[model samples]
Target chain A: MSEPPQEQPRPEAEIDTPPRGLPQPEPAAQPPVPAADSGAAPGPGAGAAPVWGAGPPAPPTPQRRRASTVHVLQVIALVVGLVGTGWISSEHFRTVWLGSERDEPVAVDGAGAATHEGLTVSLVEATDLGATPSLPGTDWQPPSGFHAWRVVLDAESTNPDLFACDVALVDGGGRHFVANLFVDSFVDGFEWTFSCGVPEPDDDVPAQQALLVLVPADAEPTAVEITSTGFSSGYIELEID
Target chain B: MRRRWMIVGLAALAVVLGIATNVADARLLPYGPTSSTGAIGEDAGAYPFTVHVSQAQAAHTVLVCCRFETPPPTGTDGVWVVVTLSYATADRPRGASGTGLVLRSADGREFPVSNRTGSGGWLAGPDIWVRGDLAFEVAPDALEGLTLVFDPGIQLYGPMPTQYARIPLDLDPGAVLDVIELSEEQILGAGER
Candidate 1:
C-alpha cells in the first residue's frame, strides 16, 4: 500500500538475489548435518548451526528405518551368544561320563584256587621220613565198636625230580596197623591220591591209641610241598561222618 | 513398549528353560540293565562227609581225614569244607531236605545240602559255596568244621595244611558266640553290624 502500483515487483526477483556472506538455496531438500559433523557433538564453528540457505528440511523416514535395523541386529547377536554357550556346555558333559566293562583275572601264589560261581577244590601233602618220628604230641584213641572210618590222602611234589610218599594208620594197640604207599607219575612231578577204609576196633579194647603218619620213602618233604606254604607243614581235615 | 517386549521375552525364555530341564531329566533317569542271580561254585578237590552224634557218640572221637599235596604255588592245590545241619524236635525227629540250606566258598559258588535224613549226615554236592537265598540254613549252627590242605600238583611245591576247628554245642537260646577267630578281627567286627 505504500509503493506506487505502476511498477509492480516481479515475484521471482527476490529469490534470485544473493544475500551477503551466504549460499544460494538449492531446489532439492537437504539434511542439516554435514559429512564433517557426523557422530560429533555440535560446536561453535562446526555442527552448531544449520547452513543459512542450504535447502528445505528433510523428512525423518530414512532415520526411523535405520533405528529399526539396529534393533534387529541386537536380537541376532543375543541368539548367537546363547547357541555358542550351549554347544560348549554339551561338549564338556560328554567328556566327563564314561565307564568300562571287562573281566580280569588275578593270579596269586600259594594254594591258588579261584571260584566264580561254584567251588573248585584241590589238595596237596608232603612229608619227610626223617621228620615223621620227630613230631610232637604222640597221642591217639580209637572209637568203640564196629566203626567204619574212611580217610583220603593227596600229595604233590614241588621239585622237578620224582618222589614217593607212604601213609600208615596205626591202631590204638601198637601191634595192629594198615598202610597205603604208592609212587606217582614223575613226568610233571607227582600228584597222587590215596583213599582207605579202616574197620573199627572192639569196644572192650583197653584205652586203644591210633596214630596216622606220613613218611617220604624216595624223597624228602622239602622236595614236595603243598601249594599253600601256610599249611601245618602237614595238616589234614578230619571229618567223623 | 520396551517393558512390554522384555516381559514377553522373559515369559518365553522361562517356558523354554522349563521344557529343557524336564526333557533332560526324563532322558537320563532309569534303572541299569544288570540283574544278577546267585550261582555258587565248589572247590575242585573238595571231599564231602556227614556225621551223626548221639548219646552213644561218647568216648572215642571220630576222625575223617583228607590230605592235600603241595603244588608249585600254594594257592593252586587247596581244599575247603562246608557243612549243614537239620533237626527234628520231640514231635518230629525225622528232618526234611531242601529246607535245610546251602553254603558257599570264598568265591561265589553254591553248595546245596539237603536235610533229607534227619538222623544221618548229608554230604554237600560238588559245589563249595552257599547261595544268598539258602544261607539262612547254614547259619553258624550248621557248621561243624572247615579244613584246607595244599598239595603238590603236576609241579611239586610242598605240603601245607590249613584247618579251622568249629563245633555246635547245645547253644543257649538267645545267646550268640562272636566267632572272633573265624577271620581277621576287623572283618568279624564289621559283620557285627
Candidate 2:
C-alpha cells in the first residue's frame, strides 16, 4: 500500500479565532464531543448564546400578555355571577315565607263591622225563613229542596263613585249560596242592594239593605262574605249565629 | 382583545336570558284580564250557551216588549238601555238563570239591571234558541265607554272571583237618545233583525 496520506494542519482562524465585535465564549478545558447521530444543524443552545448571556431578554410576547389578562377577567366574572345568583335566591325565599302570613284574614263577630278597600260591611241580622216562605209577586213558586234565609246588612262605600258588591252566605261546611233575586223583590225590610250600587257615604244616613238567600234545606250558614266583584282578596267576613 | 370578546359574549347571553324570563312570566302567571271583548255575534260564553248581542238602544222610557204575568218595573232618573241578547247552541244544551247583568261606565260606575223591568223568559230554559232584552238605567254622562257585563251566577262560599263577559256598546255618547217605542212586532222580532 502506498504510504497513507499525511494529515494536513487546520487553519488557526477556524479553530480558536472569534468573530469581530462579539464577546468570546469561555472555552472548557475538554470540549464537548458531538453525538455520532448529530445532524448537520446544531441542536438548541449547542451553538446559540446562553439565556443569561442573551441581550436584555426579548420583550414579553403580545399573545402571552393577552392570555394572562383573559385569565384574570374570567376569575372576576365567575365571582360576580356567583354573587348575583345568591341575591336573587335569598329575595325569593323571603317573599314566599314572610309575605303570605301577613295577608291572612282576621275574624270578626256577626254584629261587628269589617272594613276592606275603603268600604265597611256589617251584618244586622240573619233569619232562617222556614219552609213555605211568602212569595213576593204571586207569579213564581219556590222550587223544592230549597230553604230561604233573610239577611240584613249595612254597607257604605268611601269611593267617590258608586260601588257594587257581591253578598254570599257560607255554610259551616264550606258551601256557598247566592241571594234569591226572586224573593229579594218582595222582602221590604232590607236597606242595601245586592247587585245594585251601594250609596256613597252620607254623614246623615247609613246605607242598609236586606237580601234573601235560598239554599238547600240542610245548609247551616256559619259566616257571611262580602267583596267587590273584581276584588277577591279585599273582603270582610262576619260570623253568623 | 380576547378578554373584550369574552365580555361581549357574556353580555349577549345575559340579555337573552332576561327576555326569556319575562316572556315565561307573562304566559304562566295568572294575573291580568283573562278574557277580552269580542265582536258582536261572536260566541262569548265560557259555559254551555253561546251569547250574541243583536241591538242596543237607549231611551228615556222603555216599553215592556214581552208580555209577563206581572208588568215590569220602570226606571226613575237616568236613561234606560235595552240590550237584546240572542242565545243558541248546537252541541251543548245549557240553560242560564239569574244572570247578573250590569252596565259599567268609563268612570268605574256600575248600573245594574233595573230589577223593576225586563223579562225573565231567557233567564232559565233548555230551548236551543231564545231572545230577550235587559234594561239598565244609567246617567247620560256615563255613556262613554259603556260596557254591558254579564255574570254567570256563580255561587261561592267566599268572595266572588272576577269572571264576566264584557260587551261594548256602539252608541254615540254625545248624541241625543230619542224615545224608542217598540211595536209588538219590534219587541217580538228582537234577534231576527
Best by lDDT: 2
Clashing pairs in 2: A190-A210, A191-A208, A191-A209, A191-A210, A192-A208, A192-A209, B73-B116
Position B67, candidate 1: lDDT = 38
Task: Estimate, for each residue in A95-210, the C-alpha lDDT of model 1 and write its tens digit.
Answer: 43322222232222245432212212222322222321322332221111111122233322233222222333322221111222211122121223221112134422112122
DockQ of each: 0.01, 0.04
Considering only chain B, report the TM-score of each candidate against the true chain B: 0.18, 0.62
Each candidate structure's TM-score, on Cα atoms with residue i matched to residue i, is 0.18, 0.34
Question: What are the runs in model 1 whose C-alpha is more than 4 Å off?
Answer: A1-66, A93-241, B1-6, B26-28, B31-193
Point out the worst 10-residue segment of candidate 1 chain A by lDDT: A218-227
lDDT (Cα, tens digit) per residue for candidate 2, span B43-139: 4652334466777778777666555643444445878777777664322223444446677898889987776563532532211345667777889
Q: Report how large a share of the reference interface contacts model 1 reproduces.
A: 0.00
- The number of the candidate with the highest TM-score is 2
Misplaced by over 4 Å in model 2 are: A1-111, A135-141, A182-186, A190-192, A195-207, A230-232, B1-193
